[model samples]
Target: MNITLVLFLIVVGITLVITGWAARRTRTTVQFWAAGRGIKGWQNGLAIAGDYMSAASFLGIAGLIAFNGYDGFMYSVGWLVAYLTVLFLIAEPMRNTGKYTLADVLSYRMSPIPVRSAAAFSTVAVSASYMMAQMIGAGSLIKILIPSLDTTLKPWFNWTILGTKLDPSITLVGVLMMIYVIAGGMVATTWVQIVKAVMLMGGAILLSFLVLLHFGFNLGGFFNAIAGVKDSKTGLNFTQPGILYTYGKTQVWGVDKALLENVSLGMALILGTAGLPHILMRFFTVPDAKAARQSVAWAMGLIGSFYIMTTFLGFGAATLVGKSNICATVAPKCTPNSNLAAPRLAEYLGNSFFGTGGGEFLLAFIAAVAFATILAVVAGLTLAASGAFSHDFYVNVIRTHLLHGHVSEREQVLVARITAALVGLLSIWLAARVGATANAAALVAGVAFVIASAANLPAILFTLFWKRFNTWGAVASLVGGSLVTIWLVAIGPGWSAPRPGWAPNRSLRRDPVSTRGERPAPLPYIFLVSQRDLVGLIALDVACLLAAAMMLRAWRRRRTRPPLVAAIFVVVLAAVATVLVLLGVTYSLVVGPTFIVALLVIMYTARYERRVTQR
Candidate 1:
């Protein structure tokens, strides 16, 4: 039997055993969703680290650094720093207040049903996008290990599956993911994450060590090699910061579009981790506020160390394997794939150190580890999605509104298991239908991060700390932010423009960055809203500041009825402005005004509640 096949079976068998054992104890809602809150801080911390470091961190970031160089390392920086937001602002407060999902926190002071519905929708959306990216990476990695399997199955299952031919590897990955979540629930999922985290950290550490050994453990030599690395096609050193982010022939206020895009990506990443439903859900599995805080502390250390090692994983591939081999300039030659960089590098390093046939063993181990990474992440995402639906939507919304107000523990657990299976199936269909290319997994996951940051972050912060935040503000932030973020992504340069020579399929929609003959397409100006007159931009910013002043004044005199109607008028004005801005207007207008309006609405609602109480 092939080494990769043997390792794959071993990995699958161990996880299944864990699932079987966990299923025995998973008899109630708490066990199914929160692991009965018996998990120790270190255990949940490892799980959080495992859940957070998905295929995007392992495969996608490594490939990005291999190809894009320094620009790719920004992802590592942003993601590592993001845990601060969680530690100081979100983690303890969330555990102290909420039960299962992010909706638990938001629905604390607001109307339960509508707020829960909005939150559930956003959770599902983020999870679906994030899950699709992980599944695609898994399928692509699997295809590499067992290329013959896909070809063998293609003859019988050759019909179009979501417009692209079905690959057996994708189906296989999806089936295993469903099994993990359906059988073991959070208990099984938590242990699987703990196991995978150890495997991944070990693999990463070994790879980094070998890379250092190749350079004779000299930091200067390694840095020099990376600096002198050449682009496969253009021969430019991609190790420079601005290389990949360059926008084509487009400037905003004479500023490079690349800079703006970089900033935008950074903001999304830094804020997104605090808002991720899967990461937030991990907090509930621990006992209390102190456990939650300890877990975050442990996670930050583990996550930081892993991200630091990614520098070695990425640059090692670039210098040792060469970019041309990782992503060939010519068609189909050199095995032309970026997603396989880390595994391929493992093969090379093993051969160099241990001689003939050792490459296969190392490659097999890394491949199994990569598969475990994907499975662990997908399980967490599916659980979070199901929890949102079964707990928030079904129990809180549907049961409260239509069915009887009370729901039994057994019924909720059953509903959650059913929902997990359905969500897994839907994700499989979407991943197969889109046929997302493997190398683009990080960017694909970026879509989820952006949505989470825009929609969930604001709502979470307000609910936890802001005293005046109410149902209307919660609904607006969740629904409005999600819709606007999705719209912006749809029209952005990434999705709207394609490289000149590529086919016009939706699969190739992202602005192509090829080492081949094509250059990136020009960005649409409407998407580059910074090009609006500089004076007008400053004026709108000033107006935003004035709006802040008004909010401060309203806060000081909140008890009086005189400014109550005026606060309502400001909210109405802000709403009208938001409508106009959303209609073919500059994007900057959206952020400042929308935030101001949400605050104003909170103020008005708080005053109204006070008046009603007095009457």
Candidate 2:
């Protein structure tokens, strides 16, 4: 009966109808998986933008800017700049070689058995993590918009059930997106993404204009408003330390005036962008290497412009909305979470459209757009993972039965749908479980970056240029990087401690404190040593360096000999990683020891390569 619900249902209905129409023509596996590889360059480029700009960019980045300030911009900068590297390096070659997915390119030379299996496993892991983040974001947006909705509703709006009270809007999005992706595959997904991108860009442009208009179209006036606000009690100016430092107890740039954390995050963004399964796979949807290159160029322009607009939105939120309004609207708790910052700002500027009585229609419309954002992103993620499963895993590996007997395209489409549903369910369960813990979005995003950087990046880069690159070496790097990243996160300092009364100790144990006459000593030794920090650094260093070394060794061993391109790529990778590590160590001793160790490993790898070449 409500206007908000009505608007949402209409959108969902339209999306479902379109999806059904698109799917009616599916006649082959290629058509189902890659949209018959007939997608236009510009069209796929827009879709890539949609896939890249998720709730994280719209909600998370703005929240970061609203809360943290400069560090938040650093996140945006890191992400956008990464695309420049992708445009120059990875895009064209990937499209030229692969038929459908990253697995297709990486495993083209290897036997379908283990190579396809590894690629599929990695794709599923990366895609699942990314999807869960989108789903959680959807749930959070729903909770905010439909504050009156019950915990559950079944079979066309019935009664409340178990589970947290979800926004009916999120459920609406989930069902609609699932239907669209399941029915039409890439065709429906691409068009939906394109439409959503246009809407999102338009919304952002309007919001920015409105904010600027509030300041009489004066940029200086807006900044002046932000600079003027200083809390009397805290005695700190809002814009002084930048946003991130002001929001968190910890400094944004880093401790001891270092940029280690920033550099680490930056490296992750730069190298990781090229390796993302969903983004890389988009290149395959286009016609040729040239198209793939052009697509990247277009993506950079769109993404960059969008991010610049987001900066204005963030600063506008901080200046116009104020901290109190943001805290109340986004997160009621005093805890600093950047995810709600942008939405809070929107509600503030559009207050006449929200809160207590007037703009209910407008509020619902914005909420619907936010809901669409999550749905589009999640659908893309599901399609990417499911395509890997159906094409790379099932069709490629379980080939004998299907190859000998004629298999119907309908059956293949059915298999993909089943895989999508299975992946969606698994991600939802994982997200629900993880949501109980703190900072679920950040953790998931971090995992995605680490997987892309460690597992896929090395293999992808090597395959393109390295003549000696063998299948075994690529496999080693993929498995090695993935497992190591997982281990580091599990045991690293970032790991959250168990809640009180949940653990046997009933309190967080920070190593085991050594006492000096009832007062704590300077250091607490665990396992007779202070090994926690050392162990983590060493593990990360080895994981990155060893993987690089493995790839180099493989490159040197090929009978065909190394090409100029391959040699240049190896050197460039070495230089970038080394420079980043050194920059990271400049701030904290925590990374220095690790950097030295990594350097030593690199030197040894170089020496080994030389010996292999001579032999």
Candidate 3:
């Protein structure tokens, strides 16, 4: 048997056993959703660390560091510091005020229907976006780890199902995640995270140690290697900050486009965590606010240590494995986008220390751990999204309006399980549509963080801290912020780029007619949103929404026919503009901000006009 397959089987077997055990205990809503709140501080903390580390941290960040050098490490810095927001602002308060989901807290001081409805929409959006990244990473990792499937056994594994050719790796990952959540629930998911976290940490620590050992344990030598590193293709030094973020000579408001992009990414990384539904859901697994706080403390320590150690994994791969070896157009080691850098580095170290056979074993071991990381994180994400839809929207909003009474716990749990399965299937289909060359870290930060920051963070902060915040503001923030962010992403670089097989041949570039083989770029917003153009977009939308809200309020007392008419016109223009934007008739950068602006205008129009009429 292949070492990779064997190790993968071992990990799968262990997790399956865990799921079977957990399913028995997952009979009640409390058990299925919160593990009966029986988790201790240390255990919950480990699970948080596991959930947070994810494939993005282990595989994506390491690959980023290997390829981009110093700039790539910024991801680690942003993620590490993000916990402070959770520790001080969210964890304890969320535990105290909410029962199952973030909507529970938002609905506390506001109208439950609209607030829960909007919250559920944002939660599913963020979770699905985040889970897509993990699935992408998993697919890429599996392709490289089991290279034989690409050549020797391709036909057997890769086959068409219902006219859609199935990517064996993606299908396998999706099925496993659904089984974990639909069967085991939170009890199974938590233990899987704990196990995966320990394994990931162990793999990372060992890899870092070997890299240090290569330098004879000289810290000075390691830093020197990083500073002197250079990319073979671009010939750029690895110690700089502009490689990835400043590709063009574009300037924004007198500052380097690089600087603006970095700041935007940093903002999302820092604030997005406090609003992540999966991370916030972890707080409920603990017994109380005190335990939630303790879990955050433990998570910070573990997460801080793991991110710091990423320095070694990234720099080591860059210096030792070499960029050419990690990514190439030829055979033997044909990894794409440096997604397999960490595993490739493990193989190199293992070969050096334990020979070729030993190298293969270590590679398989680390790959298995990476696979486990994806499985755990995706399961958690599915659960969170399902909980939001089933508990918050279906039960709280739909059932309240229709049934007009309480739902049985058994029925709620059943609905949640069914939702988890459906969510997993949809996520798998969507992730499979993404090209294999996509960067996992970039995908996560660009799509997930942007949505979380734009949609959830503002509402969460206002709900917890602002004195005058109400249902209208929360609803506007969630609905408006999510729509604007999604719009900006749809028209941004990735999805708007020319479709596959559209590139002009080098020999035909001089003659326009000779390049008939090249295809034009897709219509803007025709495809799904991508993982770029986040930094400035988030700030722009947030500022526009808040400014519109404040400015519209000044005319509260002057609510006459003219203002209402203007509101109606703007809303109509926004609707038309949205359709035009999708059809490539207009650009989102011009029309995206107006989404929130129009929403807030209408909101103010309705509220103050009604009050004036009452008087």
Candidate 4:
């Protein structure tokens, strides 16, 4: 077998062995669902890291940094800090009250049927979005890791799937994820995550150290070198944030609008972590609330270090390896797609550090780690989605309709396994149909996070803190928020950027380069060419509107101008902002929903308290 495939098999084989071991121990429902709460603090922490740090963190960010520079690190900082939200607001409470899944916490006091069904919908939506990113990334990375797959499979494996071209590795992922979760349950999923996490961390640290050692450990020198030269791909300054925020450097309106897009995406990242079903579920894997708390701390350390190291990898590839070479060698999936940066960097380092064979070994190793990263993450997502399906939907909602009594232990386990397999299969089919892009991971993850921030986070927060948050509010938050996010994503720039003649000049990349310099610039790249900003606005507004309505209805149907006023203001403002974005008038996707969500929350809750006391 080829080295890449061999390494891939080794990683999969080891995980499958773990799955067998875990299956034997996974007899009881609790064991199948949460590993019987027997996981140690460190082990669970590593698993969390593994789940959080996917291809997005390892490959996507490094490629982003290699090309986009400072704006790329925003993902790093936002994700690490987001853990604080989880630790303080979510982790302990979730562990304290929750059982198998996050929906348990939502269903704790509310009617289990509607609340859990809504929660299940939100979980599946988020998991599907997140899983899509990893799926497309796994498919695209094969071009570089195993070029033959791209050449041979794309031609002969031309059997179209879901109307998209096929790749063998991409198809294989669906099978692997299904088997891992269905066969082993939480024990297998946790161990897989832990193994991938450890390998990922080791690989990142080693790569970072080698990059530093190449520059004689001089931090200043490394910074100077990165800043001194423009990016080889697009010739932009290497330390600017405009790559994510600016239109082509020449368009004043598009350039300014980029800021709003950045804020919108950042907001999602900051809030989404607390609501991620896979992440929140990890708390139950630990023994107690304290270990759950401790695990976040450990995760923050490891994740922060990994993100920091990614900058070095990005700049290292841009500087030493040359973007031209990477694009040439890993083409149709390099530079702009940027997921190839880490692998290319590893290969470069291997050549620099050892010689010819060195690159082959290093490339094989990194390919395995990245492949393992996708598998472990997909397994976690599948577990969360399927857990919600079985525990919340089947047992809590659907089972009650068909059966007279509670769902049995064996029934729950059987349903969960079946649901997980279905989820894995669906994700593979959906992921296979997706085309490759530079921000594949970011695009998918961003949608999932924004949806969580909009739909799940508010419900979770209100359920925990707002004593008066009723079933209506929780249900509205989940359903209304998810619908809005999904609709916005469907219409947003990300999905709609290719309207035949939107720009007509060719590609619509989001690079921050300008023609003011001696070198000519390419076509104008917009901040939200992928339209994350539009999704953010809709998410924030939906969250506010649903939350406010919940309070208004709960208060004896009393008329309130505040909700109406806020809605009018938001609608008017959103129309104006959307117009500006479409006409290239402004980039203020950041303005419409900024204070509205917070304002609605404070107003509604306070009003509820006053009305209750007076009544």
Candidate 5:
């Protein structure tokens, strides 16, 4: 076998062995879903980091920075800051109340029917969306590493119709993820996540140090290399101040005002973090509320460090290696894809730091790590979705008839495995159809926002401080919020075609029957590419507002509850809404002041939540 293939097989084998060892102890439904509830604070924290940081972090962020400049950091900022909401509000309460999944927390006050049903729906939606993104990323990576494999293996492995080639890599990723998740469950998934997290962070840190050494460990020299490139057309240094602006720079915030844009992106980050099912399920595996709190603290540290390193990696890509090399090695065919930039940078620096042979080896190592990163994350996602399906849907809903009050441990595991396979197939199908669309990131972000705003944030906030939060309110908030978010995203700006003046067809001749035999003047294709981000933001805001209103009206009718609980609910909803609005506005405006204001708002919200809890 080729060395690369052999190396990849070895890595896969090691992961499987470790996963098998972990699965040996998972003999019960509780153990399968929650790792026997004995995981330590720090260990679970690291695993949370692993579960949260998928191919999106390793490949997406750096690629984004390479393409979007400073704006790419917005993703990192949004992702990291989102954790604060989790730390202050969601984690401890979720741990204290829930036994297995998010349904446990939301259904605490009501019938298991609505809560479990909503939990299952939201879990499947978000997990599927997130899994689709990872699958797309994995398919893209495989195409890059072994370009010829697609052609050579296509006839045997892939489906094709009418001369169009269908991608099989998506199916491969989905099947592999299913195997690991079904065989081992959360116990196996958690340990794999921890190991992958360590490898990813270590690989990043090592690459950063090697890049620095390549530049003689001089920060100034690195910037100098970047800033020295002059644009031939403008005679201005490409990397120097005002260079982009001088060339009639397109709006960095892309159609929205700065503040609205920042806030819109921030809303996705802040709320989405709390809503992530895989991350939420991890909290259940811990022993108690205190341990859950500690896990959040550790997750914050690890994630923060990793994000900072990603920023450095982006800089290294831009500085040490020229943009042309990045484009040639990663974004071939002039497609302007940023996802491949980081790996390309690694190859360039690896060759420079080590010999050509060693550099090739290092490149293979990075690829293996990226592959492992995807596998670990997909495993977690599959496990969470499967648990929601088997535990929340089947056992709670369907199999309740057959079990006569209690389902067997073996039955639950079997059902979970079957559900995992179904989910895996759905994700692979979606990824295959979507291919390399520009809206992929936005799609994933929208899912996170929908889940966080609809189910997790409201449920957690009310349960912690509100005494009157009833089953009706929880159901309305969770189900209503999720449905609205999904509807808004479906018709949002990202999916729409641009308005008329944005795109014009230049057909040369104004009149087709001209006697002079001249070409007809171009028809205006204007409005072809104009974005609807502003419209989408407004829609999302209105939907979230409607959700809050439903919850508040329900709370107001409950005369038996403490007045303070109602007051707390109002205060918490207002705080969350304000943060969401600010984030939306900042994203629209794309100004420094807007970002600063949003940050201050987040800080104040954190303080307010703490004070309310203390009272």
Candidate 6:
């Protein structure tokens, strides 16, 4: 009976209708996987933005900026700027080569079996990691949106199912994602993304407008308001950077742990976008390379504009809602999660407009938007994963290799649907088992971004420009890089931390030991990659790979290595060396081996990788 639930139902109903319509038309493999490659520039662009701008950005960035200020904007800046890499390097090449999945491009020249197997695994790993974070976030939004499940329907909604506690909200999220992907395929997912993107962008703009309106449309007044508010436990100054990044024990993490973390996360954003399977899959939905390029432009404009507005949204949350109200408060407080900052602000805005009823209605609307964001994003992730499973693994690898056959279009579509359902169920189970999983979910997200940057991006760059990039290097880069990323992450604080506890005390901390920034002997890359350090290096690797590709292109095509490309490598390498020196020799020795080994492997493998003369 809650207004939020009603609005949510309405959104669901509409999407399901769209899904049904899409299903009838989605008979062809091309239509199911790539929407028949017929989407318009603007349409596909919006869909790309919709798919890329996930629930994490919907409220996570706003809340971080709300509480963490300059540091939080680091995520925003990196994410928006990342499109440049996508536009410059990925979109056109992917459109030219890829058919349905990213593996299509990866396996274009190489033996399809092993290359695609690695690509498929990498895609699914990244997607699942990303999906888990969104699912965790969606679970949190349930209480606000329904406002009744935790109370009136508590008994019926909360129960154990298959050894895991089944919250109806979490189950509903999985079910909806399944419906979107299974019912309509890429066409349905595309339309769903478009709808959610419009809704999300519109809601963000409305919130910003309302916030600015309250401050007499003066940006200075709004800034002053946020700077004025204070908290006791961790008094946050929205105007400052060190509050979250350089404070307390975090300061000991490094002289500039905050800076390094930001830069690292920035790297992940830039390169990860280029490598993310779902986003690349969007390029295939357009007609050709030109459409792909234009769509990237459209997506860039839209995504860049959205990020800009997040500044207002973030500051508004700080000035209007306050951190204490958002978390670590006693009674009558909004949910103790920063992710609720935007929704809480929405509720307040509604209260200002039409009293309690208006507030409730607006709150419901925002909640619905939030869920729609989750549904759309998860659908994209599921599709990308399923494409890898059905198209790459099943069709290209399994059916073609062992059976000496190809899956029918209908069979491929059916396989994709079933895979989508399976992934959704798995995510649902994972989300259900996690009690207070916000921190862990964020950790998973970071891992995904890193894997994409370190593993997938490297493979992509090598595949496109490196003529000598053979199946051996392709397999090595995909499999080796991913394993290394996972190894680093597994050894880091996230995977090592106990599953049951999620509080600051239980999590990796500003506490005395971690602050010292020394690796416990057990954690090899603990100090080297840390969490955010890995972020910086991920970007560095991407830049380095791009630089290498450029160098190769110049040497082969222009008959010499370009000085500019050489200069880029020098500057990036020197910058990295500077970071290492700043971190002291021990940190360098512990983690520096990875780059050296990777370089040596690539060089050694290049001999076996004959250049593709025709390509």
| Global lDDT scores for all candidate models | 0.81, 0.68, 0.81, 0.78, 0.70, 0.78
TM-score of each candidate structure, all chains considered together:
0.81, 0.76, 0.85, 0.80, 0.75, 0.81
User: Model 4, range 47-137, lDDT digits (tens) per residue?
Assistant: 9999989987888788777777777888888888898898889989999999989889988998677688889999999999988887887
Please give, for residues 1-615, the per-residue lDDT of candidate 1 as tens digits: 677777878999999999999999899999999999999999999999999998778877888899888888998999899999999999999998988899998998887877899999999888888898888877777777655555655676555655666657777777777888888899999999999999999999999999999999999999899988976544458567755776554466667678888898889988999989999999999999999999998999999999999989999999898777774233565656767779878988999999969888888889889989988999999999999999999988899766757888989989999999999878887778767575355556888998899999999999988899888778788877777777666545445346442434647553333322242233433343444544454455456456645755765665655455555555556555544453435444365555555555555555565665689
Quote the positional error of residue 108 for candidate 5 in Å: 1.1
Candidate 2 pairs with clashing backbones: 63-338, 68-243, 68-244, 69-243, 69-244, 151-165, 353-359
Q: Which ranges in model 5 have alpha carbons more than 4 Å from their true place?
A: 148-156, 159-166, 223-256, 328-333, 399-404, 436-438, 496-615
Where is model 2 poorest over a 10-residue stretch in terms of lDDT?
511-520
**How large an RMSD does model 4 have?**
8.2
Distance from true position, residue 498, model 2, in Å?
2.3
For model 3, residues 517-553, the per-residue Cα lDDT tens digits are 2534545344533323333334444554454445455
Find the 10 residues in a row with the least total lDDT in model 1.
512-521
Count residue pairs with overlapping backbones in model 6: 2
Two-way TM-score contest, 1 vs 2, winner: 1
Clashing pairs in 3: none
Candidate 4 local Cα displacement, residue 175, angstroms: 0.7
How far out, in Å, is residue 572 in model 6?
A: 32
For model 5, residues 516-554, the per-residue Cα lDDT tens digits are 134233222122212464454445445445544544564
The CA lDDT at 432 in model 4 is 71
Candidate 1 TM-score to native? 0.81
Give candidate 4 misplaced runs (Cα > 4 Å).
Answer: 148-166, 231-236, 240-244, 247-255, 328-337, 437-441, 500-615
Candidate 3: where is the Cα deviation over 4 Å? 148-163, 231-236, 246-249, 328-336, 439-441, 499-591, 603-615
Instruction: Provide the lDDT at 367 for model 2.
Output: 63
